[model samples]
Target: MINYNNFIRALIIKNKDIVTAIVFMAIIAYVLPYYTVGGQGANAPSDGQSVGGGGAGGGGGGAGVTGVPIHVVQRTVFQRPYELLPCTQSVVELKKDLIPTTDFPSLVNETVSKFKVTVLNVYNTPDYKAMLLAEGDEKKVLQDPHFLPASATCGEMILELLPSLVPVTNIYDVANQVVSTYHVKVVDVYNMTDYKAIVILAEPDNAITKDSRFINYNQNNTLSSNYTGSGELDLSSGHIAAPAPVLKEETLPDSIKRTFTTEDLKGNAKSNFSKGVDADIAILDTGIDLNHPDLNVYRNVSFIPGGKTGDDDNGHGTHVAGIAAAKDNGKGVIGAAPGARLWSVKVCDKAGECKVSDMIKGIEYITQHADEIDVVNISVETPLSPALNRAISASVKAGVTYVVAAGNYGHDASTTSPASDPDVMTVSAIADSDGKCGGTGPALKAHNVTDDSFAHFSNFGPSVAIAAPGVDILSTYLKGGYAIDSGTSMAAPSVAGAAALIKAGDPNMSPEGVKKALLGTGSTPLTPCEGGPQGYFTGDPDQYKEPLLFRKLGAK
Candidate 1:
């Protein structure tokens, strides 16, 4: 027609570089929007905005970006346009099997999961950090708020995903980022220690269980970490499926009998022994009877949601509290340390059921008041939880002594948390029916345990720190009355009181120092069952030496 072929060939030859440039621009125009549309492009995050999708425990995103931070990318390769829909819809409901397309550096759903995060901040004054220093005005520092209680949620969980797929710096950072991304309603951010555990309520299969931030994640049953974990609570009060056999409860008789365990421990040896005036003991249990006349409760707080008051709906806590620190009043039975201040940290429900997260929260409360609290008496038996252990380790590092029960399971105490932890003192039980040593006490035949002998129901092993009167122990009960009960639960508080007594004498003594004093001054090795074995109990093995609790705190 007009020499069109000739003309096209001439043009290509004249501007070959221009032609190549145009083709390259066309390819870039098509592929550029795919990576830049909703991710790291014009719709990028602003200052103070969190970048990341998925839930708070950091379970979101399909493929990770190499150079870019996982949190900042709006959309990733192969992600869908699910963010366009309302966040209220569940991930399961929105897309059956679709993966997140945008590599968003922001969270998807703000209110993802319920988690209680303990945020610690400095109690600094404008001029100087007085609260941090041990100065003259100690009372002022103790009164200052060291923790800002906060509740947070990440977005909805990504169903059936691997936890290790997403990487995080630490559990604390994950918690803080969740708070920021969700615009969590927090009064203030804590700046107390370098790190504070923020326990998450992740399921066993949740991605958080395998997160990189955790120190130890017990895959056997529960999930725990240096910063987060998940598990339910089992107080092990000789009830339910616990190893401690269930025992019958008895009402108080007309004549309130004197506590024989107190006398046996030499708690009543001196008049001053009845008054552990300088020490404070926190009871983490099913709560204490606030109105009990026989106990001197200093303060009470409950971590059970919707259960505000720290009242003992269950009698176990009340009984345990009385054994530790009943009043020296003439009406009620005297206790091991009658004047020790009691702080009721209720973590169990009315049925005595609890969650490990709640227990961690209680421990957080103790950590916040670590300066004022001297000892913590934990009478519960639970599986080894890294999260719970981490919290206790932090509290112990803050200078709080922890005393836990060896459990009533009649098995090795090495299987339980807190009891298994060597940092804290683990107390086993002794059936001192007459409250005297030498195995001379009466036998509790119905329970098949002899008097003044190693308790048949007490859990033992190398972890058992000490033994005390546990079987048939009578102490304070619910509704301001008295009752008789039995378990290692009773034995643990006895040692707790003894610890309080030691603290009363040496207020600045470390936890290790207190344990040494108890072990060094213990009286009488626990007698084995009659004709059972030289070192072993009736049904339990005692390859290791176990000392009985004795009061010899240098005239205190």
Candidate 2:
């Protein structure tokens, strides 16, 4: 038997042995370990595959050998502003009430024990991580925090698994330990900088309510030395919840709704519905003006660490905010999902561009609180970063729909970072409305501001998902004004709203399914293009008659 006292001192939290816990303990104690593809490969266990166990974001195992391992998410505690509070070990003991002996085994469960996984929302705060436990094991996770590992601060949440959990030889009955379909991993973490710290349960009630963040490196941005976390594991819960719905422009209140005096089609998206309650579309852009009447009601604005309310120090964030789900509460121009919630995870501020690290933090925030937001519209672009990819993937995994604006350069359709990830619906711009006229823009292919059917000065190419009305768009502005702007930046939120609408209608669609719905439901029959040189169709205003297209044109 593994020495009860001599067990590695690595366990930071202790547990109380109750009936249910005893079951788990017994299971773990008796669960025989066979060779599993722990360190590498995929080959799911043949038997004992369980779901709906009521724990973890993905999957886990009781106590048995399967073909694959039980993946556990390793949490790196970070420097949290919250203080960890001390608690009686009884809180963990109470968890036994929730567990049944049938759920686990006997031998181990009967021992002195009290443990559970950490909670999700309570601990990542300011005063929670400072509390210490009586024995250090009784402290609430809200008070505890995990830091980044020695080798890395960013971690990928591929799989939290133990190889022995999967019994290869016994299940497959094959001499070889590999399975045929073992390559489909739930995640990849060798490059993760987030999960390199310790795990802490945030509350005293039970372990399920913990908040785990990377530990603050004693040295800023540096990692620990002895940590080499297992990051290549993968597991899943099968189905994903669908996205939420957003409000449309037509449905907006008359005061805030922008009615084109002529027929301006330049905007993110358009619909014939009423823009419901002005949703708080958090624009993590430059900043927003709280005083602007047109945007004020819609400007459910807030700031990050160094920013302030009503302070759109930079004009970019304000512009994007107007295009997003601004309040439709009898204001100037109605927003996309006017009534949806908006938050500004300001990655970029007075500096003009958000750092790759900060951007991931913002995404992390959205993922952690996806229930509060309707859509996260990212108008800014980043230089390709793997960490962003993981963040985007995590956001989707967490059920947050990420809509990234395609670049405005008529050069290439796509740029970097969030835009590059297909998981993040990439929204491109199309000159649907004319810059000079209030009516719809001249039906042209695409182009810069010049007379020739020129391309946008930004970037362009195949990375473009679907083009929204990115032209001389008139929407809410900072400090009580409506402005006309042109760029792919302006067109993305339309699709974002569309995503919100889809999500609202069916909150069970996968990220891919949401993308498909938008692309699939788009109005087609419009001519391909007519601006490009020969016949490929350059994006120019001269050939702007038909702007909408659909995804299901020929597959029938």
Candidate 3:
């Protein structure tokens, strides 16, 4: 009624003007070369030179600094090689269908024929199904739509995708892009939580874009960085550097006398109260020495394919195993839980390198066989991985208690993985070279420079649940021998062995109950080492240090 047509004409003219201005601005922006300030880019000069014409004085006058032509080297993107899980090729878990026996095989065969994917073997359980498929000529099973069973619902299939040849600068950004663009879904990013940079997968179609800046794929893949060797306790170097003394069969070990005797655990061992007789404890580390005299290794299995034996080529696992459950016979050393059945689940290689996928496989195996296992001892530490965390959490739900190391960097334990994760009990190292128990029966004593103190290399913080003997601790080594090493690695197994004892004491106790019994009863407060490495002491000793691991269980 009030000049509607006139108003509409005015609006159209106004919109046209706005569009013209926007178009003009866009054109200007497109013509101009973008410049970044003091950063790596196409326009940014690699050498230290001003972008503007570089002359000292007046405009276009006198000798000017000649600009060198920048030669940009094109980065090469390598295709990553993925390792298929052995025995069973891919695992699929069904959500709705419990009866996989009837529906799964036909669905798998139909899908395989449809996609021309080859099948080798098939294994099925109540909850999940595993298909052993042949590796295709292209080695990209994930790219095939028929690879996953149509009948299966939500499930995970394991695959190990090697690290890219080039370094992945930003893991989160790259990982996000990879999931969004590629045909595969990334389940876990290895060492992304720490310093080791590798990626893990549930199922991956290697259909990565050729121009992808992130995601390194090297045929001959080495570690992104040098292996830190699990934790700060490198036997070859650092604080605890002395060579391990060779002990005769008749010689009694000091670690047994100090830890067990000091903690009043000798009574339990003598009475056979909590020796972890029927409990199964898995050691997920470098393979164990199968023939160690003091060790009672029940089964040895390796997760690394092409490397089938679970022998301790690297000495760390052997040492950790001995500390957890060496035999109690009148020989070299007795462990915390002397009667526990030991399962050597080798996750790391001979070079002490562990991939995230290998670790997940080992954990999945434990989860699958959770009924038989009661406790798991993980002496290795890495950055937090989502997939690894999920596997561990799943295992925990399946009733397996995980005991992990707090790391040896002598900083905050809260920053490291497994230790950082709340599900697991994180153990810090206490320097008790003399084997004397500090503090009165229930009261915590003040700082004792000559007595027990926190290890200079042990990590501390809120994540630490308890402390154990780790400094110069003697335990079993590789090649049927023994060695003395110190680290939170050593401390973790002491707690693991204690967990086995606790489980043996009360077979019905849950992981939380066991953790409570261990932390709540520990009375010995750790004192800071007076003069060791700089920045080792976290200002408040009482707040940072955890209580010592006491052997007296059922004390409420």
Candidate 4:
């Protein structure tokens, strides 16, 4: 056989490399069962728990079986924690035209779609901040993912849902998500067919402002009642005085004032109309004193936080209530429409300060009761707020007339809200000392306005739809007493009462119809002044004049 040992040696040498490869593969296969990248091993994720945390675009590693190391790569994707994710994208895009585009950062990574889809499952989590805190990197948490930095929330805001989100479920779903994602509390929620919004209370300088969807949401500002007197008059036990100023100025005859006629007990022909019967007027202000006997407060609600009953601790609402519809009960003071039912909507605190969101809440409350409520008296003044304006417009569309105070700053009424809004009936103030239209009455020099003329403190502009007696106005007060106050605040309620009277005449009258009736039947109180030919008031800055409010509309 020839060289058998040499043949065997050559075969062994040639197969040496293949034998070593097989052995290494066997070792790898055995180790994989207990150790793999980011898998269970001596030091890796165990029972679905993460090992170490990483900063943005960082990685971590742990020991594997036999002291070998296994490296794991952390995700590099970053996104706005409050951004609308892919789950809601399709639905949002369907109404893209209706939704305003928020200025959010562009997704830089091409892999963001996959990461966003993964985050959607955890989107409804109760607290993202807590989750990030557990990651043990507060600073990196702000930059990596899950929350906006503390710098994002600049002020308080009201979140407005797209009008197209009319469905209750959809509105709540969006609202809840927003509340959870932003870590903000919903102070109130407003949901109507045409309008949907929520008031979000945030820490100062928070980051929700960075979200594009809330770009239009403005900071919550303080609003206050427009009236200005603090002195109280004691009428607790004395003979309650009739509203002398109001009665003297209201020149409407009986025939014009009567809304319904019926036979008396003596079978004599008589009109039974007590004034504002069957009409409801909601006073949005500091609460009204419910115990005032002269007032026929039908119902009351408080929009102030932690407030229970709508009771006036501040007396402004009571004064306004008295001006609007105290009662014809021959006590305290008679209001413009004394027989009308009154509803106190307390939007302000005991200090007479209210938030813009609270005002919106008050309007929504009135709107919900629109079928029963005929008129709304808003004597508060605020800065120009688009959200407040929208709320008023929604209420007007619901068929309730809105009477707002023009303002007391003596500036352009157009600079304020609700007064500037086109849908509302803006009332300016006139100082009617003698209750007559002629400017012949002695000037109330101390109060800074002449009688039968535009009040020196009243805001004047073309937006003023009507004028009413505002200076030195006598009205019911808290603790079953009476008080004298002045401002466009006092004037607004007079028109509100007139609106109630108009609505009472024809319960089915539209808000516009009621407004038209008041405008059509108003008197020219300034006609007897020096500018009588122009119909403008004495102290008014504008050349154009608004008719003085006269509630009398002769028989239908």
Candidate 5:
């Protein structure tokens, strides 16, 4: 049977932060139904400073909002590299190509037909990972199938192996019994097209093997797989993801509502602006929570039917919405853009993903409704698809100041979806290097000087536009109350809020002008990021030191 839980744990939170990994550790696989993995992973410790208690990964949530330390996972796969033909062979002449011609293993299989089909290679640039995804006719493939590990997944993030490898006649002659080889086809995640591939593998007897070879795109990483009990084969992993979710405290340094309450509303977002003036922050996500007391005023806004509409099913959208525009009533927490309005168009689901179809719907919503929203904040990402790009281009043309997360995947120059889509301001997270890493527990202070420092979890690249407060941010959650979370997801909105403050000051500013103002005005931290692996960090802090972009962008 196909194990879906392992696939979700490995893929969704695979290579990101430690929180998700910790979840994998604590949250047992709900198998017996469809998943089969045991509940023996890792869990986060409730103790202080004890971050990495899970399997092997944990996101560094430093005390202050400085550059928090983070670690990335290494995934190496063992497999024989299949090269496309200049050396051609036919299925009728099948019996070959299994073992190396020179003292290799044996190659045998009774089933044989056409040895080749088509393939699609999809890549997650931020994660430095790629999969050869393809789908084909199952019955046809089983006719002359080869015996291997049968596969099934919960989502569409897989690469169909059989179709990509040009078929060899005697590819699996040594199998005890073919078990009536079944041909299964999978979608081509890379191209998102009808690339066909053959499936020749049945469920194994024992999940241990000693003959498998591992393949590394770069040769240094190792792969982990749940199918292999002997731990020979593994899934290609990355870094950064869900953290030990904590109840959020509703106060901070420049907190307009915390230290300064209703009376402070004079200059605060909750008081000054027109009732609906903030209906401009386009929440690019799964949807939002419009019924909440703090957010009821900005309700009834829609982009399209399934278009630019606001209905948050996925927790991410609601969480982000609360961060950008949640009402500041005494009940819930305050928002970054307290005065900002919210427009929603669903793109992701409960599992934190959206079908390409829905994503296109969301982008088109923003483009058509550009005039309605002010600062567009997007906290979603995926492999760069052409269709996705088209949507981004449309939004930019509509003159929206797009802000996106740099992604929590720690690497150099790895930009997430709309962030790397060009013309959008991509933001990174910072860590609190001071001794107060977790001092005073919730009510924290942002060390602006120490912050803006590069975070190990924050993705850096030439495409990274700016940095913001990403690590350990206290924001709104799905059910009701607030929570302490981490990710580039936290950083993007900070800049979006800043951008809104500027755009609100000058309603007629151009997207390019808005960007120049933000980057130009914010104070540059230091030069640690400049020396990063791929020159992904800012080259010099000198520029940021002289002209603080915050002053410029927020200048009324």
Candidate 6:
């Protein structure tokens, strides 16, 4: 009825709108796969349970179909005071009132729920406040008021931060990381229960920043790095180019036999022949001269990695070893226990600088070989370190007798390590100038002096266990020579050698029993130091005067 072309045009225009809508819908379907849905990214979880859902190629929620699981990384954190405690105090009591109870969970909840912190470790000491390591955002934790409580019970707080991704396997790794990341060198590593605590030294022009991992961890750990006071392992001897003539009639040179290695001290005389025959002693000091003519060094081990050989280069260890176990060969000086075997554990370098970590490594080695070694001598001194003290205590419990120097600072030995350790025998220095036998013998007159009382430089305190000849001491030196030196370093070996003698006399003697024997048999009521610097003594002069070493083997 109507014009056919016009009717067709009207129908096409009417359907054009619908056709355009269909084309737009098609374009959206193609592009929809390239974008996200519900404003969630491709990696975002759908409902906080699963990840990678409702995305371009993501699978829809299904009971049978699996999805990628979400993962949360864990970090290890540490917290301590910004400064070390002036003296040892119980860390448990320091924080006892902060938490509901002493159990680990209670402490964890207080930190976690309140500040979103994760407590990974709590290192407590009976002598000092506790240190903690936790995982959390350092900024948030520090900002939280509860993070460092205002209460006195909370004590001072220092934060130590470790990388969440890095895995710390041992102390060496911790030390390396501190050096590489912070540009600070670690001077010592303390072996804790599950962590290796480090003492760091900041580099010049690169001071440790507050943001540094060490500080952000705990400020107290930072205090350990600033402790510069150290005690000395005295060495006053010099090297003699030529060897001394062998004694024709005596098993030991008169210089030594008249003092520490005398028959009065149960020291094996020339006729005893048994010397420290079957016993073993380990010396932790500078490297020993393995090629020396007088020493019978059984083993030479170096704790200083990438350094010189264990052979004595500075002549300190050589001198110490000669004092402890120089052979009975007539050509040179004799040791207190000449027949006993010697293990030279070099923890120091030629300049006599020993890192606390190196010394700890040397201690660990002695601990592992405790069954083979009966005596250990440490002629080095450092500030009070609880870690080193624990190591020495452990070694003592393992049946090893430790003889350490009382230090040469002429101060309170209790302020120093090894000397302050109760389990070890701390030896002080006495100058026996006349080589006399009586307790009231003449004062030491050697080195161009009249009075040979306490060496003017010897450290003395309640911690000292015994006294030995340390002034103008003649012993083995470098290049197969003999020299005279003096220090508490010389005094400690005398006691160590005495311990070897005691062990040789009674192989079944316990460490405690040996200590008792040494202390009980010492020659007491000896004349005190006279005509020397007197300010070193902080206590009664009589109390600082330790008993002279004497032999009481096979006596009840």
lDDT of each: 0.52, 0.38, 0.53, 0.54, 0.42, 0.53
Q: Write the per-residue lDDT of candidate 5 for residues 1-556, one digit (tens) a residue.
A: 1100001122122222323332332222222111111101112111222111110011222221111212222222222122111100111111224222312112221122253433242222221211232333222333442322123221111212233332432222312112112121212212223332222121222321222221221222233343332212222233344333332433332222211223324345345543533447877665676665555435333433354446654345666666566555444456656647766665554334345456666677677777766678877544345566567767877888888766544544232355567678876655422111211112112212232245555556666777655444545544453444445665677677667767777888878888888776554444111111101122222232221123322254
TM-score of candidate 3 versus the correct structure, residues matched by position: 0.50
Kindly indicate the candidate among 1 and 2 with the higher TM-score: 1
Q: After superposition, how far is residue 372 of candidate 5 from its true place, in Å?
A: 1.3
User: Residue by residue across 1-556, what tens digits does model 4's lDDT show?
Assistant: 0000000000111111222222332333344432211111112332321212100000011222323332211121122112111100100011223123322223212113333322111122234211112111223323433333221111234555544445544666656776566655444577787777665433323454454443133332222111111111111122233311222122221111211111110122222334335689998887888988778888999988899989987667887888888665544455767757889998876545556778888899999999999999987765566678889999999999999887655667786677888899998877764443334344544355665677766777888998877765667767776555556777888889878877877989998888888887666643422111112246666875888776543434
Q: Provide the lDDT at 197 for model 2.
A: 21
**Candidate rank order under lDDT:** 4, 6, 3, 1, 5, 2
The reply for model 6, stretches above 4 Å from the true place, is 1-255, 259-269, 274-276, 438-452, 526-544, 552-556
Error of 5 at 528 (Å): 15
**Per-candidate TM vs. native?**
0.51, 0.43, 0.50, 0.51, 0.47, 0.51
lDDT of 1 by residue, 1-556 (tens): 0000000000011111222222332333333321110111111222221211100000001121213211112111231111111111001111212223321111111112111112132221122111111111222222223311111112222111124523423444555553343322212222233433443222233444444443333443333121223322111112233222122222221011212223233335545544545689999987899998778889999988888888877666787888888766554566667767999998866545446678889999999999999999987755556667788988999999999877655667786566788788998776654333334333554245775567666678999888776765667767776555556777888889888888888889999998988876665445322111111223236767676666655533
Deviation of model 4 at 494, angstroms: 0.8
Error of 5 at 111 (Å): 93
Query: Who is ahead in lDDT, 3 or 5?
Result: 3
User: Which residue pairs clash within candidate 4?
Assistant: 152-206, 152-207, 153-205, 153-206, 153-207
At residue 309, candidate 2 shows an lDDT of: 55
- Report the CA-based lDDT of candidate 5 relative to the real structure: 0.42
Highest lDDT against the true fold, candidate: 4
Model 3, C-alpha of 180: deviation from truth (Å)? 82
At residue 505, what lDDT does model 5 achieve? Answer: 75
Model 4 segments more than 4 A misplaced: 1-276, 525-536
Candidate 1 residue 44 C-alpha distance from true site, Å: 58
